[model samples]
Target: MKRVIQFATGNVGKHALPLIIERPGLELVGLHAHGPDKVGRDAADICGRSEPTGVIATKDIDALVALGADCVVYTSQAEMRPQQAIEEICRFLRAGTNVVGTSMVWLVAPQHADAWIREPLAAACAEGGTSLYINGVDPGYSGDSLVYTALTLAGRATGITVSEICDYGSYDDAEFTGVSFGFGTTPDHTPIMFAPGVLSSLWGGQVRSLADVLGVTLDEVRESHESWVTPEPIDCTMMSVAPGHVAAVRFAVEGIRDGQPVITMEHVNRLTPITAPDWPYPPDGRLGVHRVVVHGNPGVEINTRLGLDGVDHNDGGVISTAARAVNAIDAVCAAPSGLLSVKDLPAAHADRVMW
Candidate 1:
């Protein structure tokens, strides 16, 4: 069994720990956390498991790097701190540890990663003969990989659009929903997601990746967005949304080729069902939906939803994101030494371990 470590115990990490423990061909070695509060705690405890695994969490980066594990599942949030996440992952890779996780969305297509970030990671991988792969629910499988897979069935593909349409009312993270996404913020307040080039920077890679797969060269990438305010005050799991505050948002990063949108990545995020009545709704009317449409000869549309075992769609999304990363560990370790993408890795399957 290959030894592996988890880099953080946050939302995604919490969901991943148990899967890593139960999966076949993997042995849990260590758990790494950022704050002193989490240091020295049992891995099982950090993941909310009653049983103990004997592995303790630590904040000592140098010591953790020296463990010489086969891989590190780096799931620390990168949306807010891209540079720090890149640096940390590079450190692990340079230590000859294969790295896989959902931290860097742009690295879902490694070639699309910024030069400054990609160059050092490539150098580190070359020096240590390790590999790194970045993936997640949206940017990884549901958005990029799944879209490409569906396109294969189409005889003549004219346009492709992938969307993450979900309600954020159940999301418990106020900072993320209210502040980051501007869910409960004023209409005039510009969230980072709507800032110039931010949407393109975060999701343009997915659009470009699809174009690359279809052998279509994009002339340029463009961005468009729209938002709505809550008509009445609504109390959500995370924060309260006052009337006239931002409640729903829709944005797209379009890959333009031949003066037309050939590839697009769009998000229709709402805090309430009534917020955006005119916007596109999920086919099944589920709380959360991921859809990919190929407007072509066959006119294919694929939809996916998750709300299993009383878990809300927002949290279900977190679990799916973590699972995608955890399942890819083995493939990443076996890949060629360098930054890898979903296209470079083999199919990831759940290796059920019979206890």
Candidate 2:
């Protein structure tokens, strides 16, 4: 069995650990958290389980390394700060431990500036004879699997378009409901690009990656946002955000070559229900849906409601998305060194991440 150490005790890692530990060929040996009094806590309890294990969470890196696990699972927030995240990843690789996590945010850091991140990370893996990969549900799905699936339906396609529509108003997280979707806001409070930019950071490369696969030269990538605010309040219990929502978010991206559009992506998030009359097709009548359309001769479109009820934006959607990031540990470990994007790695289908 592959013995593993989870490097953080956050909700993501906690949710993924039980699944990992239950895998037939895997053993979850340790739970490491940076919280105070880190050691001797039950991993299951930390994840909100009633049953507790003797396994304690810890902040001692030396202890973790000495635990002699075959690999280390990192779900740390290093991704928020690109530079430091890369540095820490290098340390894990140099320590002769296989590493995996969400810190692969540097996947597309400009090749010219901070290009050193690539070479050194690659070298570290070689030096320690280790491997790493990083991916999340957004980049992993819309960027990798969904687009890849879309390409399979096309014949000599010249362009591809993928979109994810999420009604954030139905979301519960304060960061997402209030700050992300701009629930109660004036024109000056938040720009349209706020939530859309996050999507760009995660999936823009997917567009570029598809372009690379099709040998198309991309000239420009542009994004636009749309919003709606409820005139009055309504009562709802689906998400933790405010009741009777105030705002919603939707975004679109266009990829062009020589001023000609070739690829596109759109994401929509709203607290209240929505219908897109402008879309060439009918809206899925669900709170959220991931839609991928490949533009070539006889274009093909694929749509799936990935939320709570195939149309509802429930905690299940957020939890599942976050779980995808941690459950992808082994795939990331198998990927080639250096920062990796969803397109950089293979489908995360391993006994290790199956929860």
Give me the runs in candidate 1 sitting further than 4 Å from their true place.
353-355
| Candidate number with greatest lDDT | 1
Q: Give the worst 10-residue stretch by lDDT in candidate 1.
A: 346-355
lDDT of 2 by residue, 155-273 (tens): 86766767766655455455423554565665355643364466566456666666776788788776666665555553343233333344555666677898876888776655555
Task: Give one digit per residue, the lDDT tens place, for model 1 in 1-355.
Answer: 8899999988889888888887878889989998788888999888878989999999888888999999999888887887888888888888999999898787888898789878988998998899998888887787766786787889999999888999888887777546877888898999988999988888888778778778999999999998899889988786788898988899999999889998888899888687788998877668889888999898999888877778888888989888888888878888899988887876544455344
Pairs in steric clash, model 1? none
Error of 2 at 213 (Å): 0.9
Would you estimate the TM-scores of all the predictions?
0.96, 0.79
List all candidate RMSDs to the true structure. 1.5, 4.1
- In order, the Cα lDDT scores of the candidates are 0.85, 0.61
Candidate whose TM-score is highest: 1
Give residue 261's lDDT in candidate 2 (0 to 100).
68
